[model samples]
Target chain A: MMNPKGTQPEDLVWECQACHVNLVEGPVTLMYMGNRITVDLPQCPRCGFVLVSEAVALGKMAEVEQALEDK
Target chain B: MTAFTARALSHVPHVLRGITGNTLRPGGLALTERAADWCAFQPGARVLDIGCGLGATLMYLRDIRGCRACGLAISAQMLSECRGMPVLQAAGDILPFYDKCLDGIFCECVVSLLVEPPKAFREFCRVLRPAGWLVLTDVYLRNPQSGAGDLAASATCLSGASDNTELMKHLNDCGFDVILWEDHSRYLTELAARMVWTLGSRELLMQLLFPGGCSAENKQNMQGASPGYGLWIARLKGPKR
Candidate 1:
């Protein structure tokens, strides 16, 4: 239950943006893939949307933040 | 010589998983839930729980992930214990499923019980789809020498522990790419102590259930006691086709 220190790879619980179902399981490692795009090797369990890798998810915080702000 | 069947101890996990969540004996529900939640099961994912004793973890998965879940076990008695739930009788060494059938596969404290862990890992690999996730929590070796005494010991509830290196090797050879592997030794060691002490206090009852001296004291007195166990997450490699 410890919060991640900004640069640390945070173990997060995310929902599918399209379906709103929680993506509660899988390994998401944080890596720099040039501007940080979340690479979901495994797709969403319900909708088959590619679930992003942990690294990508952590790296793409700005995009996720923007998307969240937009919503 | 005493033999233990999965059915005989089926209710143990049923009651324990409800209490502990992770099904590794008497750990608190918080640790158990944290273990289960750590798998990060995707919503509506196809998950197969091998040796889904008592269906407790499966229940957790169903409730949390809303995923389609199925189970396989060798003990009809244990399978019966899971009655009215989505479970099938099968063994870990040879799971009764087709290739790439599951997105996530989980096992709890049951791997070391397998007579052939390599075969079991192969079976796990066979059933998982490419990049499919695997979540496992079982006993491991903290100090390599601690496992030596049990190698030749007769089968008991705790008879099937594998060292950390062997476990990792089997998973890797079976085509799984390791992700997160943790040495939950302190937890297992603590459980081993508590398991012996608490179960010893209930020797008469366990004798009634097992009938042939599978009590906590008997297991504790044995030379091959393990102090460390592990939890691992790996991915099945993509299909050849």
Candidate 2:
């Protein structure tokens, strides 16, 4: 599996827990602040499962929301 | 930096400027102007701004203080937005400048986000001329353990934040003398509140921006995190050896 930018191995390992397939990095659409934004993330190539690391889920995402809302 | 985190940090200045006007940091241009005043740059003095964001403070220094200012930012998007301003794509920890060349440095709200803050401090000392002033403002953890184990909070510049003691230690260890330290946590809290009010519903806004990121429990933890913000003015020790 290719490593995503800004993600360290300890931060996240791209493998689907259910499908047991190594995740590949790609752009995936997710709902943010009621808007659909496409962001790069690790996902299972076979099962389409996106992996959200704890840092990305809480840290970056929350900051993005706050910044957008401030606008 | 991860693509998402980079995008988020790059987007913050543009978004906040739209709402809060020119100054992107917590206390606005007033605080920035005050910091510039503290730096006390002489006419034609050369200065650098670390993590310059949108170059607002650089402009202020040039136009208001008669200083020749350049900025360093990691975000290409931000540098492009600067539109001919003397901003380079660079990180604070590895400044691309000759030793003891700059007259002063102005860094706001950027320290907490640094991956290697101690290294950055050392770099700051290296770049500044002897007795050059360094003005900085950033968030710090009021209670070190308040956000322990919260990966998200760490990402938001809330985790790994040092209190006054640690900051002073870094400055002194880096061969800088503290000139001033001011608590501005109230202003930061006010800014946060203003952002929430502008969005109408904080929870709703979070849901939209980071679905599955902001749970009720996480929000509660953040509320109780006891974060604080501060501004510091220091000077590099004289006669670089």
Candidate 3:
């Protein structure tokens, strides 16, 4: 998680908003966000989730909380 | 075309010497900087540079980072030119090294042209130690729209960047953790224009260099219209064992 020499996060981080996984957990010269203000996210090391976006995480969080209450 | 490619690679050393004061092309130096800037290479780390044309990038790493480096190239003629330097003539797919022995792997503009990039990727992974860095800077397809024909037309032992997604998939499949990839389309477009202009303006010389290509003007026009280049940097994953 240390910054590689001669680089700093210019704008946003390469992090998954869902499981909070970092695709590239270190410094990068350039980061590509395919469309919109996007962040590059890695698959969850523990959960094996894919295509985890911020919107998806918010929706999932509500489902989890409601499920816990039901239990 | 194979003959042309062989001759072209032979001439690269001379051409590169002229362009760079350090006896390598600007692109080679750029790749060196890319690796050093991105990877935290410890002093005296063993480095392997796949397709180390003219050994310029390796020299840069030695000079800048004080890392012990070696180079491998396919062209014996090119390798012969690297005599007295730390380089060997070798294939990217079948590297001459033991498993998990190197601290880093540097491949600049080499993998895209391979008949089997996965093989090359696996070889790189095989040679790299745990968490070893894999830094690459090469041409890649920018427009996914340009399908097989475009790839076939441009395919060479030197370059055959079909598409970005496919390129990434191959790296991932080869067990490399993709750290960075970028489309350097604009830069390559501009570079192509420069090459075309440089060769096309000199009719006799252009013919001499590119032999069977169209007329100088036509060649220039064709090179001008192509899609651009790309770059990638990845990390070699540790072996399964």
- Please tell me which predicted candidate would have the highest DockQ against the true structure: 2
lDDT tens digits by residue: candidate 1, B1-241 = 1232332233453323332444434243333366557666667888887877667767777876687888777767667867667887655666667888888887777776776777778878887888888877776545556334433243334456567787888888889888888765545433333332223333332343244445344444333444355778888876567
Best by lDDT: 2
Ranking by TM-score: 2, 3, 1
Query: In TM-score terms, which candidate is top?
Result: 2
Candidate 2 regions exceeding 4 Å error are A1-71, B1-10, B13-15, B148-155, B205-212, B215-217, B239-241
DockQ of 1: 0.01
lDDT for each candidate structure: 0.59, 0.71, 0.58
Give lDDT tens digits, candidate 2, residues B1-241: 4221221262553334555565666777777787877776777999998888778888888888888999988878777877777888877888889998999988888887776677888889898988899998888766655652353443344544566788889899888999999888755655554454344446644543344476666565555556678989999987655
| lDDT per residue as tens, model 3, B6-58 | 21243553332433434333243655676677888877999988787767777
- DockQ by candidate, in order: 0.01, 0.02, 0.01
Per-residue lDDT of model 2, residues A17-70, tens digit only: 888888888878655444444456888888888777665656555665664444
| lDDT, candidate 2, at B99 | 91
Model 1, A1-71: lDDT tens per residue? 23757653235665678988866444333233211222225445677665545554444433443322221
Candidate 1 lDDT for residue B93: 66
